[model samples]
Target: MTFKLDPKMTLGYVQLRVQSLENQKAFYKLLGFTIIQESATEIIFGSGSTTPVLILTAEEDVVPRPSRTTGLFHFAILVPSREDLAHVIGNLLEIGAPISGAGDHLYSEAFYLSDSEGNGIEIYRDLPRNEWQVELDGQVNTATEPIDFQGIMALYNPERAWIGFPTGTILGHIHLNVTNLDDAISHFYLEAVGLDLMTNFMDSAFFMSAGGYHHHIAANIWQGVGAPLPPKIATGLMSFSLILSSTDELNKLKQNLLAQNVSFSEVEGDLFVKDLNNNDMIFYTQA
Candidate 1:
């Protein structure tokens, strides 16, 4: 693709329309997020910032995401260090939270879980860049191996109480389940959306990134080919923000979409676009 997003660009808030705001808030409270703001039917929360990174809204008629739908696979939360990761693992264990799985990816270690409403979540810490395995072509070498649960837990001082996600905790990336791999890649590629190809996993998934990071966005066909999108009022991902370092990067993205003949709408200072799966993407400058 002809366009490359600025390396400094990263993900911002992930908004979800849920069926029960009270239940979701109670669940996130266990994960260390402080309520930044709340209303009768919505809540915004983050680890240590006034700028919330997660938003949950309850709509009266919202339904659960239907089967075989193109929507969120997971949203990864990047912790600052391996030790911090261990702390989160420990917290979950202590609270009897259901852990979906865990893995060692060579470049990073991560574990997965689901929220009360079935939204997937990942908690992970990256290996130092110097330690990451990268090919001469700049594609990251990713591996799926069993993580050392014993070793990670060893780093945990059960002596310390669960506080929550650390100050540096941020929304690292978001993964989606699309209807078709080829069509999704066409919409998500470097030239199309300003990301460089980082890795293509086993022909089933594509990982793309900006600024040489492993991935800021990933999509897969693991659910099925030609999966249908959920209803507009489904309880899952509503939209997510991609935060550019400056307005210049946002403008460049606008130009890239125009070149592709893709339709996008700008509201206030933010640009809104939809992917092949009908997932909403908000492109904007950093807060």
Candidate 2:
């Protein structure tokens, strides 16, 4: 934990493999994302920029992820305001999307859903930083209480048309299903990646982040206990990016990774490595 992560760094994008391309594309369209790039095998979507927030690649007849697999649990997309979150809910209601759960963490309000491939997705809005709760140790505390549905609905402006994610919409955070929380914490995240610990949930889940703005990454063994990595063609998470703020930070991480002899690949000048479960994580700095 000696390497101080740059608080400004955030998740870049998430890549998922799907069984059906058109079906997943249709689902994302309903959630208000525009296609930025498309091909026969893959499609990339984003709110406004050429930089994609979500990437879906078609993998036909691949083995579906098992219930207790160690892979993606969910990836969250953070909107700018509560009203934006309301807009997302309103749209989901119109499409009859199956909402899994809704929670008001002390720091944010989030609604969850599952895609056709059973990949979890969360759309949420963060409360202002000034409103967040900080513990005595400079870490944050979060509670999974029920959201105020009435108040959230009140913020929805039926007068305004719901556009795709606003210009500021971002790929916020990612939660993963791992086999061992201790290994993830000691071997990967805290010791090598150098993230700040935020909170621990029942000794089953650990939330960590670069800044104190809540969790940028979380790992849990809720379903996948002592599981192994999914097959290469598994229909779930393909890869994700852990972006760095500067080349110096990226180089420091590279050095740490080398010290541990973690095998990583350099793709187009960016570094990519795999976690213990073999999930690919690319590291790079934004221009």
Candidate 3:
């Protein structure tokens, strides 16, 4: 099906439940995000403007533990451009933040890191749309190669520092650790949500924006299989909500789910479903 997606409907921000507010704030600050608002139980950090990129809600009574629960995998952040990404990388290096991995995914270059509370964070910038290589079958190609770390660093200009993310930038994607990849894919792609399937591995699934911006949400049977879901008492991902651009898109998604015989419920206009890993995903439309 040929579908067009409204980029404006992309993810706006993510709220993470953190066990220690102090540590979470310090970690994000090192990545150059400034707190935009704060309360006794919650702190919002972003590009230092009104829009927050990440939200941390402190819950001290519950200790943190790793699980296959419906919490967060990692909230991916999109940078304005390659140089902007490089500037952030340079700043990260200056702060001595621990780097987990880096890759040249033909479509984009990305660097990964984990926060003090063990939250995964990805900083990346996409290549120009025209530069993306697609197969005859319309599948996008990505590869992991050595990135030009030094070359990117050279683009860093102290005068052109990254103050905060610009408007139109968004939470590009959300990855989750699920129990079964096929089940998760069926639930999200062919069933409840009508996002086009972008790519897949034996144990992972990727769904993308209608304009084909790689993947907006990805799930894998990696760390969260044969594991228990995160307790509501624990601090982590609460739920992920997808905003559709139009009422037609929302209805189409609902129709598709019915055709697939998928089981779900609606509450106050939001369609809710649990993936194979039991992570809750909610869908709504701006209309």
lDDT of each: 0.87, 0.85, 0.70
For model 2, the stretches where C-alpha displacement exceeds 4 angstroms are none
Candidate 1 off by > 4 Å: none
| TM-scores for all predictions | 0.96, 0.95, 0.83
Q: 102 in model 1: Cα distance from truth in Å?
A: 0.4
| Cα TM-score of candidate 2 | 0.95
Instruction: Quote the lDDT for 209 in model 3.
Output: 55
Q: Write the per-residue lDDT of candidate 3 for residues 46-90, one digit (tens) a residue.
A: 663566567788876866755555456777888888888877787
lDDT (tens digit, per residue) of candidate 1 on 2-68: 6778789878889988998888999888777889999998899897567778999888889999978
lDDT comparing candidate 2 with the true structure: 0.85
Supply candidate 3's per-residue lDDT for 134: 79
lDDT of 3 at 146: 90
Residue 22 accuracy (lDDT) in model 2:
94
All-Cα superposition RMSD per candidate: 1.4, 1.5, 3.2
TM-score of model 3 relative to the true fold?
0.83
**Which residue pairs collide, candidate 1?**
1-191, 2-191, 5-194, 7-211, 32-164
- Residue 99 of model 2 has an lDDT of 90
Positional deviation of residue 109's Cα in model 1 after best superposition, in angstroms: 0.6
Clashing pairs in model 2, backbone N/Cα/C closer than 3 A? none
Worst 10 residues of 2 by lDDT: 182-191
